[model samples]
Target chain A: AQSVAQPEDQVNVAEGNPLTVKCTYSVSGNPYLFWYVQYPNRGLQFLLKYITGDNLVKGSYGFEAEFNKSQTPFHLKKPSALVSDSALYFCAVREGSDNYGQNFVFGPGTRLSVLP
Target chain B: DARVTQTPRHKVTEMGQEVTMRCQPILGHNTVFWYRQTMMQGLELLAYFRNRAPLDDSGMPKDRFSAEMPDATLATLKIQPSEPRDSAVYFCASGTGHMNTEAFFGQGTRLTVV
Candidate 1:
């Protein structure tokens, strides 16, 4: 079983300030982690994924996430926050290819409120 | 430009009425998923299918909720006797065979059961 957790229900950041959304996961075998953003009235759009290789993975809209194996956390980060960046963020994880099914588990979600 | 498309972006109906939501997955994608999103529960996986065959639907309410992939392109979720608690955004997603691949999501259908 693969499960994810986003501790914070809401995060507020001032514009131009660095922002971080925390995520942690528990899974069997290997883990395939993903971050997604959802704007108002829109579907979730892929941000970045940490499959293998580099621990720091860059994604769309100047967003990035670092995969920390020991800590079992993959936190999404941005150098500077923008008002438009305020949205709902989700963290998802899947059991390694060693497993199957649509068993993609998602976190409770974090609402980012970037103040201008 | 391939993406999942969902129909009836917004639907409002009284309780006890049947509600059907449709989804068209991306071409060549072999897996389809149905999820419900609400403020309280966040995102909940309702069901999923692979190659038009249902693999697991334990998360769904078997009594009133049913999902089917009639064809490769079409997937539908039906709810009978919908309750107010059922009001939420239903999202449909699809992905290829690769387990590591990411799933593409539809804009979602906001179903409001009054």
Candidate 2:
């Protein structure tokens, strides 16, 4: 079974400062990881995905995530944060195998709060 | 830009009442997914369909929940005799068959059961 863990329930960051939201995964084979963001009363929006890449994957809204194979970690990062960046984030992983259909296992979620 | 569309943005109903939600996926996208979200359970994939054929529904409750794509454009999820525990925001999403492709999501239907 593929699973993801978000270490923190919430992360507080200052505007214009860098921010990091940590994520780790457990899968049987090579992992397909993803990050998504959700605002209040809205559905999730895709951020980025790491399939078989160069480890550093850049995404929308100046967000990026690094896929560390040995550590089993995929942490989201933003060099400079904006107040609008505050939202709920999720980490997901899809099992790697012969399964044609992708079933995503999502983390509990991390609430990001950016202080102005 | 093309995106998934969902109907009945909000619904409030009594226990034991039936509720239905609808979704229209992006044009040309072959895969459709249904998910439920709550404060406790971030996001749970309820079902997914490929080429309008049901692929996986293991995450959903078989007794009360049913999802079907009657046509190429529409997908519907129905819950019979809903309980307060069923209250949550139900989301509809769509994507291509490729693993790297991103899935687009609808605004979601917030169902409140009393």
Candidate 3:
């Protein structure tokens, strides 16, 4: 089964500091990883995705993620955090092959707080 | 902008009452997905359809819950007898069903069963 794990339930970071939201995955075949952000009362917004490309993929709002095949991890990163960056982050994984069907397994989510 | 749209942004109903949520996908999208969001379970896939056909619905409780895409423009998820535990935000997303395409999400319907 394809699954994603976000180890931290909450992450605290200071404004202007780099922030990292960790995510790891388990899948039978190659994995298609995605990062999404959600604000209060809103649906999940797609941030970035790792298909088959370079290790690092940049996304919206100055966010990026690095796909590590050996580590089976796709960690979301930002060079500098802002107070508005505070939100819930979710990591999702789907098997690269079609065998797993169309569903993508999502992580429990990590709440990120950027303190000013 | 092209995006998925869900109706009944907020709903409050007594327990045992029927609740129905509706979604309209993007114009050219071929796949639609239904998901429930809660603090305990996070985001879970309740059901999904491809080409207006039900593809998977195993995540939903079969007894009281039913999902249907009556036409290309409309999709509905119905709960015959809702319970308190069913209170949560239900989201609908649509995608092109092609490899590497990300699903676009609707604002979601917040259902509260008292």
Model 3 segments beyond 4 Å from truth? A99-101
> What local lDDT score does residue B28 receive in model 3, on the 0 to 100 scale?
91
The lDDT for every candidate, in the order shown, is: 0.92, 0.91, 0.91
CAPRI class of candidate 2? medium
Cα lDDT tens digits, model 3, B76-111, are: 999999999999999999888865778889999999
Instruction: Please name the candidate that would achieve the greatest lDDT relative to the true structure.
Output: 1
**What is the Å distance of residue B25 in model 2 from its true position?**
0.8
Chain A TM-scores, per candidate, are 0.94, 0.96, 0.95
Cα lDDT tens digits for candidate 1, B1-114 = 998999999999999999999999999998999999998899999998989998889999999999999999999999997999999999999998566789999999999999
Could you tell which candidate, 1 or 2, scores higher by DockQ? 1
Model 1 segments more than 4 A misplaced: A97-101
lDDT of 3 at B11: 99
Query: What TM-score does each of the candidates earn?
Result: 0.97, 0.96, 0.97
lDDT of 1 at A20: 98
User: What is residue A85's positional error in candidate 3, in angstroms?
Assistant: 0.7
Candidate 2 clashes between residue pairs 3 or more apart in a chain or in different chains? none
RMSD (Å) per prediction: 1.2, 1.3, 1.3
Worst 10 residues of 3 chain B by lDDT: B95-104
